[model samples]
Target chain A: MKPFDRLTTSACALPLASIDTDQLIPARFMKRSRADGYGQFLLHDMRFDETGAPRPDFPLNADAAKRAEVLVTRRNFGAGSSREAAVYALVDFGFRCVIAPSFGDIFASNAVNNGLLPAKVSEADAEEILGLIETTGAAVTVDLHDCLIRFGNRNYSFTIDPIWQTKLLNGWDDLDLTLSLSGDIGRFEQRDQAERPWARLPDRPD
Target chain B: MTATRQPQTLFDKVWDAHVVTRREDGAELLFIDRHLVHEGSFHAFNKLKEKRAKVRRPDLTIGVADHYVPTRTRALSEVAPDIAGMIRQLDDNCRANAIRMFGFDDPRQGIVHVIGPEQGLTLPGLTMVCGDSHTSTHGAFGALAFGIGASEVAHVLLTQTLWQKRPKRMRITVDGATAPGITAKDIALSIIARIGADGAQGHAIEYAGSAIRALTMEGRLTLCNLSIESGARCGMIAPDETTFAYVRGRPLAPAGDVLDGAIAAWRELTSDADAAFDRAVLLDGKDIAPTVTWGISPEDALPIGASVPDPAAMDDASRASHVREALDYMGLAPGQALDTIRIDRVFIGSCTNSRIEDLRAAASVLAGRTARVPGLVSPGSHLVKQQAEQEGLDRIFIAAGLDWVGPGCSMCVGMNGDLVPSGERCASTTNRNFKGRQGPGARTHLMSPAMVAAAAIAGHLTDVRPLLRSAS
Candidate 1:
């Protein structure tokens, strides 16, 4: 996973709310190997019509938005499904950060693990940022260290779990971070085994 | 001097018991009691291989091949090679890791969430994790269960633990009695409709109230399964006699004195009298009606008596536009009566509503009635299929003209061969009605199993109550 601290790049606005993971990368596209990039499949249905023609009206189809690394959208972005491929699609599509009023709990967790920042701002601030991006096709800056998002002259603070913030700032995968406390985990397991024997499973015969 | 303990919610009790360690940043290291994996875990297995990490506790980790397994037949040879590969990958990965897999050939094989509780892997006061979002279905057993991403799946496979910050607790209490024919699915859809999909965001919801207590274990599972749709981290119902009875004789559950002791402990898994919650919501069960989703999102639901909502009537511009977009994709016109809308086909199977009770409900509705449109009724698990067959439910479905196929997550997700065709609308007993969820360009109307059966008979979205009344 790439360590992400700050990124200043072109941003696109998808003003829609409840943009679910299915829309991010549909279930059918998930069957492919992750080694094959998912960038082309990101919002595939929304970006194209039934006959496979690109929808020119979609903001991401614009030449400037095509190169965008930041996405500004409404509340409840990445709302459905626990598919991590959604985050992979965003990262593979060159999005380094997603700014929204709120995100699905699993999606936000998946985002940070893949070095993609899920920045949460106030609903009004999200709307403002999305509008600015739509009107100006602006380049926005996301500073993880300070937890701030800068669009043009206006600056808005964003919220992320401090632990996630630490992970992204260091680009540490969860396993590495978790494995650091192996000793404590072992001790806890022993104590738990004694206290709650019912929770522990007996070994099955090989 | 010792201070008196503050009253705790059911979520706190379960979560606190599983906490192995706490970081200064407020994230707790949770010890997962059960780790359920499906075919989707292949990515995590690949990551594990890259890191040269073996599964920490293979005994606690269970695998089921469902997502990509064909429901038409048990033969993998008949399936599309790419789809068949997914099941084989899970089989090989589980074999390599020494994990117990209920593979496609296993009679117990089914949707992960459905089989977890059926096999007694899901228990009260335990912490369970899975790659699928509907893992919350196990919370009906009073467990702290939630879905994780593939990266988190790898982390759990490596360490048998997960890092997490505690989510706030919300209590949704439903009192009063639901009228006959109003099912748990109706209650769940009503809750999501009132809460607006993201209403329970950032919180773990504990469902309480007389109505909740009255629901059977299957009903509770169906209710909790849809919690993720409300943006909740997880949803749980305090374990009671219903939960204990359901878990009592299951194959994987504790037996004899151990079972007795386990039930005694589970009895204590409820919220205390004065427990405080971060948020509280109250809904009258009597107000709930047979509900269905007319638009893409689950929250775009209304009672059978209502009409499709007009986007122009919505006060919020963003919400209005979303409604407009959903209407366009669904091929629905605003102000159109929901029950009058016609459907091309029907599906009655998914992790959300394919248990035996759900099957029985659909069968009761379809008995002695021929379906006007074609449909399919796949049970939640192979065991459920066998049980339904024993009870003659399969015969009823077959007689009604709906295909009685093998068990898997069929039609609910089109990952397998079963798919609703493009431009054709389907009344389905699945969780999400998202665009292309069932298949590309397939319009799905989400409802209860019995409701789906009713629609299958009527060839349109109609109230199931009248048909259910006639059945009785």
Candidate 2:
């Protein structure tokens, strides 16, 4: 995964609420391998009609949004499904960051692990950013180091888990950080075996 | 002087007991008691292969072939190659890891969430993780269960632990008694409708009050299965007699004196009287009616007697536009009566409502009555199928012209060959009402099994109460 320290790029506005994972990348497209790029299938249903014709009215299809690396949407973005393929679609489609008032819990975690920033700003800040991006096709800078987003002379501080921020800045996945605590994990397991024997399942033959 | 003991919510007790280590950054390493995986876990297994890693605790992990397995037949030769390959991958991965798996021919094989509890793999005060979102269904047993992504699945496979931040607690109390027709599905829909889609965002909800306590273990599972639809981290109920009775005598559950000891420990898995929650919501169970989703989001629900909501009547511009978009996708008119809307088919299966109790509820409604439209009845598990058959439920469904098939998340996910036709609307017992969740361009109206059966008889969305009244 690529390190996500800072990115200044053209941004697009979806201006919708509760954009779920099924909408992000429909379930039908999930059968394909990730190695086969999911870029074409990102928002597949919304991007195209039943006949597979691209809907010109969609914001992402507009000329200004064609090269956008940032997406500004409303709250509960990527709301349903725990499919990591949703984040894979976003990253594969060249989106480095998604700015929303809030995000689905699992989606946020998947985003960070894939080096795609889930920048959570206040509702008002998200509305402001969406308006600016939709109206002016603004160039937004998402700075992970400062935990801030800047566009149109306005700076909005975003909220992210501190550990996630650190991981994003360092390009480190959870396994990288977790493996460092191997000793502590082992000690806890031994103690837990004594304290909560019922919690542990007996070993079964394969 | 002794330090005062802090009163803890049921979620707190379960979560705190599993914490292996806590970081200053607010992340805690939680030891996963049970890890359930389905065919979709191939991605995680692939990641493991790439890293040359082995599952840390094979004993704690179990696999099942459900998502991509064919429900019509267990024969791989008759299944689509891609779908067959997916099921094969899970079987091979489990074998490589020395993990127990309920594969295609296994009688215990079912939807991951359904069989977890059925096989007694899900228990009280445990931390369970799965690759599917509906994994929260296991929280019905007072367990701290939630879904994880592929990368997180691989993390658990390698370390037998997960890193998570503690979520705030929300208590939803349903006080009054519900009417006969108001099933757990109705109560769940009412709660989601009351609180918008993101109402419980970032919180772990503990369901309490008389109505909740009265629900059977199957009903509790149905209720918790939809928790993710409301953006809740998880939904749980305090383990009680119902939970203990349900867990008893199951294959994987403790037996004899060990069972007695386990029950004693499980009995203590409840919120202290003085425990405080971050938020509290109160609802009258008597107010809950047979409900259905009229739009894409699960929150776009209403009682059967109500009409579709007009976006123009909404105060918030964002919410209004969302409603408008949903209405457009669903092909629904603003003022149209929900009961008058016609459905092309009906489905009585899913992790949410495919247990024996759910099947019996649907079968009772469908008995001696022919369905007006085509439908399918896939049980939650093969065992459930056998039980339903023994009860003559399969004969009733077949007599009514609705196909009775094997179980494996058939039409609920449409991962297998079973899919609702494009542009067709289906009255279903599945949890999601999202666009194309049943299939591409397929519209889903989520409701209870009884409600779905009623719709199959009426060929549209109709109130199930009157049907139940007449049936009785």
Candidate 3:
């Protein structure tokens, strides 16, 4: 792993409420295999012009925002269907953390499970951090140890669920969780099968 | 601790009763009754094969190959390479096991959810599971359905069971007749706008009332399909005559006595007039406008003539943050009128609104009119594609210069080899408008299928009510 990493990138703020998964990574890009390069397609609809030129009007085209590692998004940041492609795009694009006031339930989990830090801060804090980053090219530092985030000279406060916090901190997904309990699970299965013969997998006696 | 249950809501009753075992940490083990599998579930099948496990109920398990099957052709041997592989895997997996499968060549071939309802495989008072999220669409017919992962799919295939924590129940009621041009998509979007997407988080939403019941089965399906967008496990409407009528005469639907008993049981599945919910939200049909999702998420939506919500106007931290970022990504300034925005292409299809009704709605708009911009109309399933041909809807689409392609979830996520080219802005019917939902660098503006057609004709975000009025 990258250690208990702390990254402070200029915040590229998108000030629209409710960003759906499509805008993160459109469906056309989802055709290619995960290894075939989808990150380059991120925001294709908005970032490029008819001739595929970078839309100068796009915030992503702004030189300062181009290198941003922190994506400051609007409320309901990951709404709509639970497409993991959205997370894949963001993660692959070098966006290590996303700061939004609110996030979609499934999207938040999807992001967290993919090792992206999805933080919920107050709108004021979110705006302030965004403002600081955009105006001053300020950096935001995420400290997993204290469950806190810092932007510029000020410390921003937010709450992430402890369970998800632990998961993100440890980069553990459901399979990891199950595997961690393999010992107890194995014992439980053995004893249960011995006592109740019908519960074992495959249902065929060895 | 029984809370005087009198005519409890299906959402409430089903939720509470499903709690098999509760852990102190707020998760629970839920009992699953029916498991729905699809083409994508071949991975799960392979995983189970590695373990050499057998599916629990060959009957309870149902598989379909909607994702990879091409709607244009019946010959499976000649499909696109990527899609053909998935089709072959699904067939091989389903045949090797005793599970029932709806193969691509079957007359019932279509999207798993579409076929599930069409074949009457979806019924009231049953908990259904699938490997895809929109499993909630079955809830439109009063079934409790949710999505699971590949591993979970394997677990269900092996054991015919899954673990789930019971969610709180919420009821959203719509009263009165809808104004012309206002569709189920508009209603669902309006509710999301009011609740901020996460309003129904951790809750199972039961859609009830006159407007919900008045909808066609397809309309109800589109409505229930977006429940996950609102962060709910499912959205449901009680099984009424409308539900039964749609299920009748299907290949696998229960017949005669079986159907009669099923209907009788469904009659008792509704929430009594006295039923209450953890949360109740009421909307008048007249208040709903021709809605379209303006930003990335489904919740980030507005009526046809409405202006984008000004981020500066929001007081809530989360709401404000979303407004700003979504606007920035959308390239739409705050308070900008959504109708004024120009569009380069229009897409009409996907799981959300790719049924026959959706096609008809688009065809009605595109009839005798050439789209000012590039346009595409993709159906949800092969059956829908065939039904449209029988009704000549495909002719109208083709005459209008819109690509009339086969079914198979085309352009929804670009999984089946259909995609919107990068760097293009599209008015689309499929759910989500994330940065590149249509393709890498593709910008999507989520809207109803009719709206997509309207956008195609005008070459921008245009209102459909006037077009509808003119059509008549």
Interface C-alpha RMSD after superposing true interface residues, each candidate, one decimal:
1.3, 1.5, 6.8
Q: Which of candidates 2 and 3 reaches a greater lDDT?
A: 2
> Global CA lDDT of candidate 2, please?
0.90
Better of 1 and 2 by DockQ: 1
- Interface residue Cα RMSD of candidate 2 after superposition: 1.5
- Number of the top-ranking candidate, with lDDT as the measure: 1
| Candidate number with the higher lDDT (1 or 2) | 1
Q: Predictions ranked by TM-score, top down?
A: 1, 2, 3
Candidate 1 structure, TM-score to reference: 0.98
DockQ of model 3 vs. true complex: 0.20
lDDT of 3 by residue, A69-161 (tens): 788866667766555667767877777788888886667766765678888888777777767766877667887767678876789876677
- DockQ numbers for every candidate? 0.74, 0.67, 0.20
List candidate 2 segments past 4 Å from native.
Answer: A202-206, B1-3
State each candidate's clash count: 0, 0, 47
Candidate 1 C-alpha lDDT tens digits along B1-472: 2458888899999999988888887889999999999999988999999888889889899999989889888788988899999999999999999998899998889889899989888899999999989999999999999999999999999999999999989999999999999899999999999998898889999999999999999999999999999999799999998998898888888888888888888999999999999999999999999999999899999999999999989898888898999999999999999989999999999999999999989999999999999988888999999999999999999999989998888898888979999999999999999989998999999999989999999999999888877888
Candidate 3 docking classification: incorrect
